[model samples]
Structures are given as structure tokens and as C-alpha cells.
Target: MKENIHPDYQPVVFMDSTTGFKFLSGSTKKTQETVEWEDGNTYPLIRVEISSDSHPFYTGRQKFTQADGRVDRFNKKYGLADENAEK
Candidate 1:
């Protein structure tokens, strides 16, 4: 509860470099850049490499390989499918 001991926590604008997505949030990090927000006010601007707007996981762009299909392919490659069927 000491005064003047905590860093400034203020509204800042974070912009995604790839997707050009911008959001306003409170952050203690300081930046020299400023951007005017929709509220007609300027805030510190921070550029980020990736954000939820452009992330593969969030954007549903991630590739998911089916394990069952892979196993079937491997079995066919080594002719194991026929051996299992005979057993």
C-alpha cells in the first residue's frame, strides 16, 4: 500500500502486426508510440507479432492429423493389415 512504488497502470492500445487487430487494455508496460482510439483519445501503442485474431489455434487454421488414419496407412505400407486379418 506504499504510494509511488507501483508502476503506472493505464489504458494502452495493442496492435497485432500481422492481422492489424487493435485492442485497448490496461498495461503497466510503457511505450513511446501513441494511437488514437475509437473513443477519440490517444493511448500508448504496442505492436505484437501475433494475437488471437491471427493465431492458428484461435483462427481454426491448425492442421490436425487423424491418428487412426495414420495407423491404417502404416499398416498398409508394411502389409500388416493382411497379417492381422489372418490372425
Candidate 2:
């Protein structure tokens, strides 16, 4: 309802610093940098430390430890009798 009171919401190009990946998005954040997009137009450029392009979670490079089941944990903690070993 107000004029010139709100920050400009415009298309911006966010670039991942690690992967050099660039994507177009809209934001109100200010930046002095600019980049020519694929469409041959200039847009504000914002560099980010982490993005989906290089994130371990998004790229499936995350390491996860397999949790031991209840029986396995109990056996390791109190030593279960090894029936197969005896046979």
C-alpha cells in the first residue's frame, strides 16, 4: 500500500563460491556485483559459501554410521553366547 518504502525485489543471480554454480532467484538483499546471465541480461550477483550444488546432503556425499540393532548392541555390551562358534 506504500510507494518506494519497500526494498526492491528483483531477480538476482546466486553463485556458489565452491562449485561456481549460478542460479537465478529473487531477493531484497543488496549487492554491488553484477553478472550477465544466459539470456544476455545483467542481474545482481550474490556469492554463497554453500549451495545445493556442492552440499554433501544434496550431492549424496554425506557419511552416515549404520546404527546397530538392539540384539547386536546387547551382544556387544554384555557378550551373547555365540551358538555358531560352538557348533
Candidate 3:
């Protein structure tokens, strides 16, 4: 452990601009913006384009693609689908 050599780790607010989702966490990143948190304390505000709140993987709102249909077509052409597997 060294003194005066590490970046400052402090409470910061990550805000998702698209979804307006705010999260409080400790980070070494600095920001010029400040936001008043629910605890009545001002913390550094970092704006992010995407977060878990708006991401497709986290929200499970991903677009349905034709890849699955293509896989079914391939399976049917190669007779890979087991009849018992369907039942």
C-alpha cells in the first residue's frame, strides 16, 4: 500500500441518458458534472450511452432475428431434428 500514488476512488453516479437510470458506485473516474443523490449528497455524475437498464442483454428486449429460422431449415434439410426430441 502506497500513499499519494493511487487515483482517488470516490462515490460517483452513473446516469444512463437514454433510460434515465441512475446508479451509485465508487469509481476512480472523474467528471465535471455533479448530481445530488437521494441521500442528499452531491456526487460526480457520469453520463453513459448504455447501461444494464437499457442494454438488450440485460433487459431481454433483443430483436428477434431470422438466424433461428435458418437453423431450423438447416436441421430439417440434414434430418438432424430427432422426432422423439420434439415429444
Candidate 4:
């Protein structure tokens, strides 16, 4: 370990912009804004656009689209019969 060679790893608060969720964690990221947490401590506030709170995958709101390729799209667009539909 070298002296003054590592970033200052300290407690950080990540705020989800959409869900307004905040959690405390450790990081070396710097921030100019901060808010007092429930524990009566002020930590670095890092506003994030997406987090587990508002993420579609985490919130069970994600949509799964099956890709059938361009051929399937062309067939469906012009009402062309699908060869696979015969089976």
C-alpha cells in the first residue's frame, strides 16, 4: 500500500431520481450535494437516473420481446401466410 495513492473511500448515498429511493453505501465518488439521512448523518448524495427502485427489471415491469427477425415482420406486415403456422 502506498500513501496518498488511493481515492478517499467513504460513505455515499445514492438517490434514484424516479423513485426517490436512497441507500447508504461506500464509494470514492465525489458529490457537491448531500442530504441528512435517517440516522442523522449527512453523506455525499449522488443522484442517479436509474436504480433498482425504478428499474423495469427490478420492479417486475420489464417487457420481454421475442425477436422473430425481419422475415417474420415482413410476413406479418403484408398479411403473408407464415410457413410455420401450417404446423
Candidate 3 ranges with C-alpha deviation above 4 Å: 66-87
Candidate 3 lDDT trough over 10 residues, lowest sum:
78-87
In model 4, the worst 10-residue window by lDDT is 78-87
User: lDDT scores for all predictions?
Assistant: 0.92, 0.93, 0.93, 0.91
lDDT of 1: 0.92
Off by over 4 Å in 1: 63-87
Q: TM-scores across all candidates?
A: 0.70, 0.68, 0.71, 0.71
Model 4 residue 69 lDDT score: 87
lDDT of 4 by residue, 3-83 (tens): 999999999999999889999999999989988999999988999999999999889998877688888888889999977
Model 3: per-residue Cα lDDT over 1-87, one tens digit each: 888999989999999999999999999998899999999999999999999999999999999767557768888899897666655
TM-score of candidate 2 against the unseen true structure: 0.68
lDDT of 4 at 13: 95
Q: Which stretches of candidate 2 lie above 4 Å from their native place? A: 63-87
Candidate 1: deviation at residue 10, Å?
A: 0.4
Native-to-model Cα distance after best TM-score fit, residue 86 in candidate 4, in Å: 19
lDDT of 3: 0.93
TM-score of 1: 0.70
lDDT of 2 by residue, 1-87 (tens): 988899889999999999999999999999999999999999999999999999998999997765977777787789886576554
lDDT of 1 by residue, 6-26 (tens): 998999999999999999999
Candidate 3 TM-score versus the reference: 0.71
Instruction: Give residue 67's error in model 3 in angstroms.
Output: 5.6
Q: In model 3, state the lDDT of residue 16.
A: 99
